[model samples]
Target chain A: MDFSSKLLENAVYEMSQLPGIGKRTALRLVLHLLKQPEDQTSRLALALENLRKEIKFCENCHNISDVALCEICSNPRRDKSMVCVVEDIRDVMAIENTSQYKGLYHVLGGKISPMEGVGPQDLTIASLVKKVKLGEIKELIFALSSTMEGDTTNFYIYKQLEGVPVKTSTIARGIAVGDELEYADEVTLGRSILNRIPFENSLKAN
Target chain B: MDFSSKLLENAVYEMSQLPGIGKRTALRLVLHLLKQPEDQTSRLALALENLRKEIKFCENCHNISDVALCEICSNPRRDKSMVCVVEDIRDVMAIENTSQYKGLYHVLGGKISPMEGVGPQDLTIASLVKKVKLGEIKELIFALSSTMEGDTTNFYIYKQLEGVPVKTSTIARGIAVGDELEYADEVTLGRSILNRIPFENSLKAN
Candidate 1:
């Protein structure tokens, strides 16, 4: 960890501050940047600076965007009545890639993880509640992960919408589409069986 | 791989350009940066910029440095007659950490890798040869990794130093200090046996 230059040390230290990158990895990355053309480093630094300073979050869904409202939230074709609530923008991108969901998304930013000192207020829960109270959304799908934190966040939001006339539901928990039943976890397999849709209804989709 | 924002996409793309980092990991890192305070991003960018713009290479050894001459190259106590040639500054740092070597280092910047289109001319081999030709160095130790490229680079440099009044040696290739014979690779184990040192010489070191 003995750096020959203060500049090199500072660069590596800052790079190592990133998640999952160690000092060695930071050094390697910084060395790589040094090896590359100066333009590459300039472009990378500019992109990161611009993204942090100028990037916007969707006012409606809180998803990362270039403008006040993201493309998804502003799109007229997307179903506004059914809003899929997610933990973050990554989840939104994951769902969008599937092209299966026609409804809109409401990103929670993160779950209610008391262990990390991230409570309900830390997320966009209040805005979500206000959106639901406006009565524009008919169905609020809880698309958060099935962890304890995810469950807590979902329940907290559900409680906030008490008697608000919104039909709250959670995403289906089951074996993935192409996964082998034998390899499925016990809880997921059990839930898949318990929540099995009618054979005719399943056939209608495919 | 569709990004919600152009700025986010650019940052992720630039990040993914780093060795071993893919799109998913880049996205994760960019999102983590976004969640952190804006100062973190600014400082990281600034450090990288400053490092790239202001970094210097030692005039004597070509090691990355803040000034024309690195600390090792300028140190009066170091053995100027015995020079250890290495692949890069990382190797220099690794050897320095051992604290066993008192000789100066000559960083070649990189090995001669034909597969990667890196030739001997691309490195500081010519300068090293010039230094050796000047008759200041009594011995030159090759400390590059034991790979085809490393061997090629070493041989190339050795050929360049032909007829020069200097001793040429390579770092010992053998089983690690504490490695078990049973688990050691056959080549290393065999080499270790073939190049066994005198019992008295081994006993001299702690």
Candidate 2:
């Protein structure tokens, strides 16, 4: 006999397609769900359903929202002149969890990757350029990851706003305490070199 | 600001109820769901909703199924005369996963725990005795855990079938190699002693 149920197979297949979930893990998760009260899994299903049916991308920044614009974009309290550009909605949520930033967000959908055929046109870069053309933006902080593709995308965005008065900045990289010096990759090492900070009493003599 | 949306709070509250999931993990999971494409989360919700609406316990074995009797009970090839009683559906699933057991099953829902107010009368033991009275079943296997409640529950089931003409038996116990003997509790140790097997070749010769 076949080793799995049709519904279980279907459910596992769908779950495996999700980010970070593979076939074996998906099967285990499905079995775990089966062990729980049917309501648990049922509620998960309802959340998924509501997410698709009720949520929409914000018209201005393309961030996920249940209304015309996302909460951040719609709110008057958020800094309209300062936009934090990120690769996806995940980055936005990560920043929100920190509770530090009050700026609006622009989700690029994905970073430019030549090998993956994800060019600048594939992202929301053109829309971002159009937004920047309005000249209301005082700053555009690039909170992208410090990978090769991320650098390439950042450089691409930088080139687009060359003549604009907006001040662009990438997140600073610093040496991590307790990190093995031997295990430190060359790029991080190089970035640490470029962004080195001053000692506490070094400027006293000067 | 409180720094948490009402939707985010609701999602976290629901996720916190899951076993092994804590507040921070629940928050992470909720944020991950919120970051996905709206359709993805919606499909997840639909699957959960269908889980409850589509599933029902099998009337015979109490195994979760889409119908009255599970596939095992309704199958003609399985041995109907041999019944294996278990503590829960998870035990039934464990045995079924082995694919070697061809007999029917009786799920007790839980063990007989006086501390927890679970008694034999609350279990499906009466129905099991009724099945035994039909005079067709010849063997009854107890696939219970080796815990105190398991032993007590097994003895209760044994007493309930005083003269039913069925050969009753529990699984064998022995010294599991490389396992910590010091950590082996008294119940397992006593059961192992009760079912000891002669290890020395000289003893067999004698």
Candidate 3:
């Protein structure tokens, strides 16, 4: 049917703008919302308004917060001595769900993609450096993607802390242990060789 | 880390409520919003709010509309006499996307179910029967499921329209050709047999 209603057309246009949601999906969602009671649907509107008017970025970590500092940065129990640097706050959240690491985090705001017009200057790297210079941190983990830009970021960050007396580490690279050798990609094989353990020494010790 | 603000907690909670979206995913969506330029994120919120606020239900068909009548109901080219009945407005939108159907639609709001405390009174069936009784409509299509509740609804609707002149029809039911025998269930087999083609009748007529 011809879409002549301005409200529906606007609603469809707005829903289409969301990531992974298209015009058709947007229409579906809008229709779904319309099926709900006035109270529930209106409350959703209130939530969206509140999200815009009330939510604020943390001044310290650039993570979402209502206050000046984010929860991760302000938590006293979190390990402040070891910091994990990520491309964005989403990465921080992903790592947090794994429950494997206890270190505090620094959200870079984004990777240094010159093609995308994002540079180190555009990120929170300056704040990161200042935090590192505080003399409390002993290690920095580069939890970035394995893209060329990620490598460039790693080298740039390594140079930034050249004489800072801190150990820098990247997450390991290898084929998944049970994965077939034939299925391994070149990058995985290369990283496996570069990070190969001392197999002979371990065998002799055993 | 402990959530320090209700904004963060609320975003996380709301995000988690969406299907397949967890607390971490909500955090990701919120954090992504945090990194965006203020205006872009503001638009997302505005869009959401507009979606909730501006959208209204078409009184005639219950489809979403910006005004009193939805686009479909207002369209002069659409056949007002043929109403495609569906369970939800989302289904209406889905059918609308095909750009093939020209008939008007009747959203049942929900199917009848005794166990769920949903009866004939809970749905828009009464309004539908009234619409049919107006004597303008020529066909009443039962696009409900082929399951037990769908059958019950069809029977109830058929009973309600007794002595009416409009012809009634339903979406077809039968086994899909080329489906593996091993995978075909008893219900499908029975349907296939019941709806068996009359190859012998065609041959004899020739």
Q: lDDT value for candidate 1?
A: 0.87
Supply DockQ values for each candidate: 0.92, 0.23, 0.28
Where does the lowest 10-residue lDDT sum fall in candidate 1 chain A? A197-206
List clashing residue pairs in candidate 3: none
Evaluate residue B180 in candidate 1 and report its C-alpha lDDT on the 0 to 100 scale: 78
Q: Is candidate 2 or candidate 3 better by DockQ?
A: 3
Index of the highest-DockQ prediction:
1
Cα lDDT tens digits, model 3, B1-206, are 44656766665666455445567656766555555666665565556566666766778887656778877888999988877777765556545654546788887877788988889998889998999999999876665544567667767887899898876765334534333222335555434433433322322332
lDDT of 1 by residue, A80-111 (tens): 89888888887777667656677899998888
User: Which regions of candidate 2 deviate over 4 angstroms?
Assistant: A1-17, A21-42, A74-77, A97-99, A114-117, A177-190, A200-206, B1-17, B20-43, B87-94, B110-125, B145-156, B162-164, B173-206
Cα error of candidate 2 at position A118, Å: 3.9
Q: Model 1: clashing residue pairs?
A: none
RMSD of each: 5.1, 7.0, 6.9
Residue B47 of model 3 has an lDDT of 61
Q: How high is the lDDT of residue B32 in model 2?
A: 68
**What do the candidate models score in CA lDDT, each in turn?**
0.87, 0.71, 0.70
lDDT of 1 at B179: 83
